[model samples]
Target: MTDPIPEGAQEIIHDTWEDGAKRSAFYTLDGQQVGYRSWTAEGQIDMEYGIQDGVQHGVFRTWHENGQLCELSSL
Candidate 1:
């Protein structure tokens, strides 16, 4: 199978739908999105995704809604 979808983007089925939510994962820009997300019963995002660069080639950080550090990852 193809490599897993990148970290930031997801695809959704758009048949008769205005939003693409049912589609599976997708690529975000050219890179993978760097975090996981928590959702509510209604499918709203609750927590941010946690992600780190697969390599130590860049700098990055993830934060909570209150601006607290959730994770510090580098690529």
Candidate 2:
């Protein structure tokens, strides 16, 4: 494994990758599964997201790490 993701270390996301693997993603902080954006084996974005500091800041798109479509918001 390149970088082993920690369990409940802060985040836990799951989905199917285009290459075909039960893909999973872990976060950078307290471990809350910050986001989930992947396709099913059948092809569908099993996307998920979360809020930061009480505002939507993570996983804004069905596309993980690419929420470019979401409007830029300020606190």
- Name the top TM-score candidate: 2
Model 2 misplaced regions, further than 4 Å: 1-20, 23-28, 42-48, 51-59, 63-75
Clashing pairs in 2: 9-31, 10-30, 10-31, 10-32, 11-31, 11-32, 11-33, 12-33
* Model 2 TM-score, all chains together: 0.29
Worst 10 residues of 1 by lDDT: 20-29
lDDT scores in order: 0.38, 0.42
- lDDT of candidate 1 over 2-74, digit per residue (tens): 2223433553322222353432222243455533334333444333323346422233444555556566544
Against the true structure, whose lDDT is highest?
2
- What's the TM-score of each model vs. the native? 0.28, 0.29
> lDDT value for candidate 1?
0.38
RMSD of candidate 2 to true structure, Å: 8.2
Reference-based lDDT, residue 13, model 2:
49
